[model samples]
Target: MTGSLRGILCVLLSAASPAALRRAFMRRQDEQRKGGPTMWRLRTLASMILLGILGILLATVLIGGILDVRLSRATLDHQYEERARIAASTVADIPEIRTAVLDGDRNRIIQPLAQRLIAGTGASYIVVTDRDGLRFSHPNPQQIGRRLEEPVSVLDGRSHVGIDHGSLGQSANGKAPIVDGRGRVVGQVSVGILENQVAHQLDEEIEAIALYSAIALAAGAAVAMLLTRAVKRVTFGLELREIASLLQEREAMLHGIREGVIGMDAKGRVNLVNDEARRLLGITANAIGQQLDELVPAGRLRRVLAGRDAGADLSVLTDDALLVANHRPVVVGGRPIGSIVTLRDRTELEALIRRMHAVTGLSNALRAQEHEFTNRLHVLVGLLDLGETDEARQYLADLASDQLISAEDLRSRIGPPVVAALVLAKLAVAAESDVDLSVTADSHLDAPAADAQTLMTIIGNLIDNALDAVSAQSGPRRVTLQLRDDDHHVRMVVSDNGPGISAEAVEEIFTDGYSTKSPRGEMRRGMGLALVRRLVYRRNGTIDVSPGPGARFEIRLPLSSLDPVASARTEVSEESR
Candidate 1:
């Protein structure tokens, strides 16, 4: 039965006009669209206002009802008191009542006459009493001759009106004195009106107050609805879900990227700084909503944010990290919104680029050597084709001898093929760069100092740097390399006749991103020397630079096991001298 009843109710509702139902559906959709903060605040405000109005109306009604009840009771009490007094006065003036009370006769006078008076006046009770506070008559037969519940007020020579309890419960009662011809009071007559009729009028007043309060509540609700509609109009119609989705998308995009991103509003506050940005700049989480200049002081970043400075490839150095930043203004609707700063780490990329440069240098050097060897072969071919067989033979013999000497020289100097190859490669690179690479005669190493790769990196970077140093010099650009190895140590010295390093800069040259080679308006160097220092130190080596007319760098590496270079050293000293 319950299911069938529910089905019938659903069908009845669904059978309503389609247009009306469609309008209701559209209204619900519209409410959902405009249901974000503006509508929420509207609902809250309207509810509060409506509640306040209803509360005030109810309070007023309650107070009025209480006051009306009290006033009506007072009025009814006054009327009943007047009625009781009039009845008591009239009864006391009656000859029979006066005679009944004075005679104290229950059967013939006081009781029977009091009953007649109560019946005629519609009073709750009527009583006749003597001046000595003894009752002559009462409605209850058992108390017909008993003394009155309270002392007689008429005995004090005054009429009395009051509310008191008696046999018929509580009532408004009035007492009057009965006097004889000589004006001496003999007895008293009392009349009472029930309290219920007085209070019944107060109930009517309360009911009227309740009805008015309900009407006021309904009116207040209508006003609240009007105000709510006004608030809905002010909201510009945005769905709560749409706003949330937009906020969530913004948060996800800002946090998902690896690059550091910072956003500033038009008020110069950091409004959208992300985790990566905080990590890069050493900024704390509380930097949000703080002044941008306070978080990242007035510097390159500040200038970039302002219109005074702008660049896509600008580099900024923070507390510990070097950031390559791209900054641009965020414009919207032909108006400037704010600005966004995108930062990428440049120190790692610089290291990678420097390593690639070394590899390319090695390849270029090999190509140069290959070309030189081909030219030599062409010369031998030309000699043989000219029918100068003997000259060709001598040339070939001299070439073989030179090759043998070069091989022996390499063997005598550094026996390790990787070190030899690196040196040969650097030689071509230096030549191509228009710098003369001179290997001093005193340089000799019978074995490898450390790993070939380590030595290659150390020697390659130093030679490249030395070559760079001399490239700026005007005349006879020259770099000298010296190597010496013994049982305990392998030493390398690379010097150049260039402008040389400053005393102050030499100490800082090996620090990451601290470059002495600053090009015109560029900031991408100094990683090579830092790499060289790191590799040398890893093998427990020492590197030093001598302050001179040209820069000279010396490094000494501890060898695990090395052959003696004393004999070769003596021969090299003699030959050079």
Candidate 2:
């Protein structure tokens, strides 16, 4: 129903003048970009409502007056016809009139009686006629003893009422028969009231009806005005066109943004969701008006969306995307209304950052190697200049043995080339930071699982976190990593010995956006462990934090089949080779 109304309003608004349309279009765009207040110069809603009400009242008055006039005329005709019948019946029953008519003296006695009756009963005329239709009495004395043109209608001894065109004028007329002592019809009596007299009475009634109608119309107009004021107040005095333009701007803004937007009521029901939100959350448009618990599964995402776990830049891992969300509470008139949450997809950005870090680490290692070689060459040249040939030979032997042993040991211990490279880079970074970072002697692993990216994220974040933890502490900072793989599962343990984690921070450290470190410019903190937890959980793995002298994290993941994309890439690379 609401959609249909909006469509109708759109059609009507489109039919407006072209200049108005252009103005409205420009205003809508400005509001969407800068959120300016609405200004409408068109007809106000109050005026339209007032005009409509007045038109209705006018039409009602005209129709009602016409109907009232017709009904009043009908009533007057019936009433006067009945009055004439009664008068004629009274004259016919008089004994004097009967005797006068019987004696053929109607012309002498009845004419004066008829004149008296015409004055008393308000009739136009009274006529008395014999059985042969010869008029014995009439309003005109000259016509009294003349014969009537028509036959006596009441010769059957019955009373009759109808309209008559007599000598006086058209009138409501009635007739009755006068009987003798033998019960035989002797004569006829007729009475009539003029149509003009009935018309005068109808005019008086019409005046009264019109007065009442005017009073009702005035009352209706007053009520309509009051109602219009109330409606205007409710709408904040916005014209119909302004309201429609705001609606259009709202729709365009909500759908045009790249960030996902969700609006919820105070009761935690979703009231609005933009297209980006629906797509990022893997939900349909039907999610609107549903509770957060219903739209999203029970997890960190649902908790963050419901404002149960409130924070800015909180990271949530959905089924297919990693999202950063910010929650802001909405207030209106100093009362809590609801909240709005904005989401950004960081999956691609995070991947790029990781690759950049890897490249940076490789460059750092090369630089370190070049510096060490240059120092060694300086020593060799000095030894040669001092003529200590035997000492230089022993120094070369020591350097060669040290480099070959370390490289051979790491390659034999870690079978995957990527993992070996990652450890070597971390070792160089650890040396640069004056921290002892090493792999356990018993650590052993086969080639990586097909989902190597997941492994890299988990291993990289854990190792970097351990390094950061120790870098800030004094004295001997040490970090250790152990990896093991079997037919069914892979296991990892990373522990650092610096200022160890406090008991209170054991569970909190894994929460998104909760960091012990100070904030960096524009960069979010404390998302690493949150990402690890989500990935491990998704793969049906278990992770536990043991009581720590330094922080110790242990994880075990069940092995799975190769990733299709990774497998395809490997096949293509092998064919090229």
Give the winner by TM-score: 2
Tens digit of per-residue lDDT, candidate 2, span 314-345: 86766566688988776432445467788998
Position 555, candidate 1: lDDT: 94
Per-model TM values vs. the true structure: 0.46, 0.63
Q: Model 1: per-residue lDDT, tens digit, 255-288?
A: 7888887766555566666788888787865976
TM-score of 2: 0.63
Model 2 stretches astray by more than 4 angstroms: 1-57, 68-347, 361-392, 447-449, 497-516, 545-550, 561-577
Write down the worst ten-residue block by lDDT for model 1. 568-577
lDDT, each prediction: 0.69, 0.76
**lDDT value for model 2:** 0.76
Name the candidate that leads on lDDT: 2
